[model samples]
Target: MSAPAPIPDRHGRAGRNRPGSRVWLFAVPGMTLFAAFWLLPMLRLVGVGASGPSGAMAYLAVVTNRHYLWSLVSTLLLSAAVTVVTLAISSLVGLFLQRNRFPGKSLLLAMLTFPLAFPGVVVGFMVIMLAGRQGLIGALTDKLFGESLVFAYSLAGLFLGYLYFSIPRVILTVIAAAEKLDPALEEAARSLGANPLRVFFDIVVPALTPALISSGAICFATSIGAFGTAFTLATNIDVLPMAIYNEFTSYANFAMAASLSIVLGIITWIALALARSLSGNSVPATA
Candidate 1:
């Protein structure tokens, strides 16, 4: 019998190339990009973090030092608050927007989600314009209460800025999740005499839980590392990002800043990882 002929590739070559060679060819670009952009930076950051006077223990400053610890804790708490509030408000608004149709429905949705087009710095500026010393709220309070109420340079302002950006992101996710929900399940629950709240909690909430968890993780991660907003309104706030900024710039404490950054990245990564594992899917997190 004659030997079997070799298979031809798309170019009509006589013989097949190694399968692993094709795989590597397909993967090399991505691997190179990852190494260049992600792996290398991470390694450098780790090395920098460990190069401090405290050496490898520099990372412990996040918990050991008073200011660093407070900043880290405050950032986590603020991010958690933003995540919870964003999920709650977005869930309601997204479901309402999805279920109802009105004359200005499209316009309303555009307005609600318009913030997604704005960066964190812009969001922070908007927050300042709304709550700054000369802002509308301050003016109104000045007229009504004989004193201007300004919060644009404090934690309240940071919270508002975070909430502003977070809402649009979460609402988009919630709307997408809501659109995929099975209407029949809600109808079935209603037919059984389940109240609106009961149906929502039992049917709707469960259905959207995965999306919520995933989006909430993303929101937390984004808020944790949010620099622009914190920078814009950190007069009295002490979020980790602001702290890191101060360390790197004002104090020239590069090692401490690197350590803090590593800690922050680790926390955010763990949150994203847990969400992915729980949801059994990838969730895109904003930096």
Candidate 2:
């Protein structure tokens, strides 16, 4: 008897290839790209971080050393504040925009989301124009209170810059999530004699909780890593981003900068991971 014929491929080749033998070929490009773009760069960064005078101990200085630790702490606090304020304001505005219909509503929403199109540097510049020495607030305050109020080049300015970008980001996320909510749940809560506040807190807030959490995490991460705005406004302050910039540029401490960068990346990754895990899905973070 003739030997059994081999299985034919789609092209009608006489014999079939071992099913999984060449699967590794499919992964080559992906692995190569990953290694070239992500893995190799990361490994190189690690090596650089360890290339300092103190060697691998420079990474530990991020938390153990006083100056670096203070910078990290300040950045954490600032980012937390920005995230909370952004979420609070965005939640209200997003809910109102989603629930109500009024003249110019579309225009108002367009204006609100317009900042999403602005880069970090542009947002920082806008903040400066609003809070700078010659800005609108300074002019208004000078006339009203006999002082040209200026905080745009300080921590306050940094906070405002963070909020400027953060608000639009969280607003977009909140609005998207809010639109998907069921009005029936809210109406039912009210039908049972729950007051508007109760309905809001119990029904609306709960429904929007996931969005809020994820968006807040994104905002926090952005604020922590933000540099352009901080550079424009935080002339007298220090955040992690600014610290890294100073280390890299001003002091030319590449190793220290790399270590700080790694630390910042770790914290940002943790925030993103928590957001993903708690929201039960991956939430894309807008810059």
Candidate 3:
């Protein structure tokens, strides 16, 4: 039998050799940075927790510890609450912005996105000033309601503080999706005898699902890993991040902290995976 002929080059060697074809070169630097800073550290963390003859046993003990479990539960609950609240408020705001033209709409949009530019620490401080007992709103509410609605150093306070930072992120994500939507879709549904409420449920809301999932995942991840906000808003509230911080810094338990950090990383990764899966299956009502 004759030897098999060499495979023909696709796109020709010339095309492959073009200067722009070296785009992969640009990715090298980013990949190098990511591998060094993020990927390597994450691997080291997981490795340290799961390595050695006793490492698995040690990690199991940490994971099964009642205190650690409680901290994880509290963090998840708080993150979920923040995610839901952010989604609700952002969806409404995004829908309003998409459907209406208002005076100072541009200014409002700018202000809404302004929080993204601030450091998390600064945002936490702002929340404390606005909602703490001595703050204006807190004082005013106390005077009117005869009860102090102090938000600082409490779980409720932490939730509200997270909301202040998270809502803006959700709004931006949802609004981008909303802008891509065709208003005519809703109008056509109304013309077809669907009521406004039915049209919203049947058409508008479904179109926003992908955006909502994306935003919720982001908010969930941010809330779970938040350090500055938790530190400032509720030092007494022990969440997973706080637990990890204490284990590493206060108790000097590097192994335990690394184990907890790995757990948090895995949880965030699972959330992101779920979001991607949901987004992949979601169909835009506009189309």
TM-score of 3: 0.85
lDDT of 1 by residue, 109-197 (tens): 89998988888788888988999987899999999999999999898899999999889888889999999999999999999999999
TM-score of each: 0.91, 0.87, 0.85
Each model's lDDT comes to 0.90, 0.89, 0.84
Candidate 2 — what's its lDDT? 0.89
**By summed lDDT, which 10 consecutive residues of candidate 1 come out lowest?**
15-24
Candidate with top TM-score is: 1
Error of 2 at 73 (Å): 0.7
Clashing pairs in 3: none
Candidate 2 TM-score to native: 0.87
Of the pair 2 and 3, which is ahead by lDDT? 2
- In candidate 1, stretches whose alpha carbon ends up further than 4 angstroms from where it belongs are 1-21, 282-287
**Between candidates 1 and 3, the TM-score winner:** 1
**Clash pairs (backbone) in predicted model 2:** none
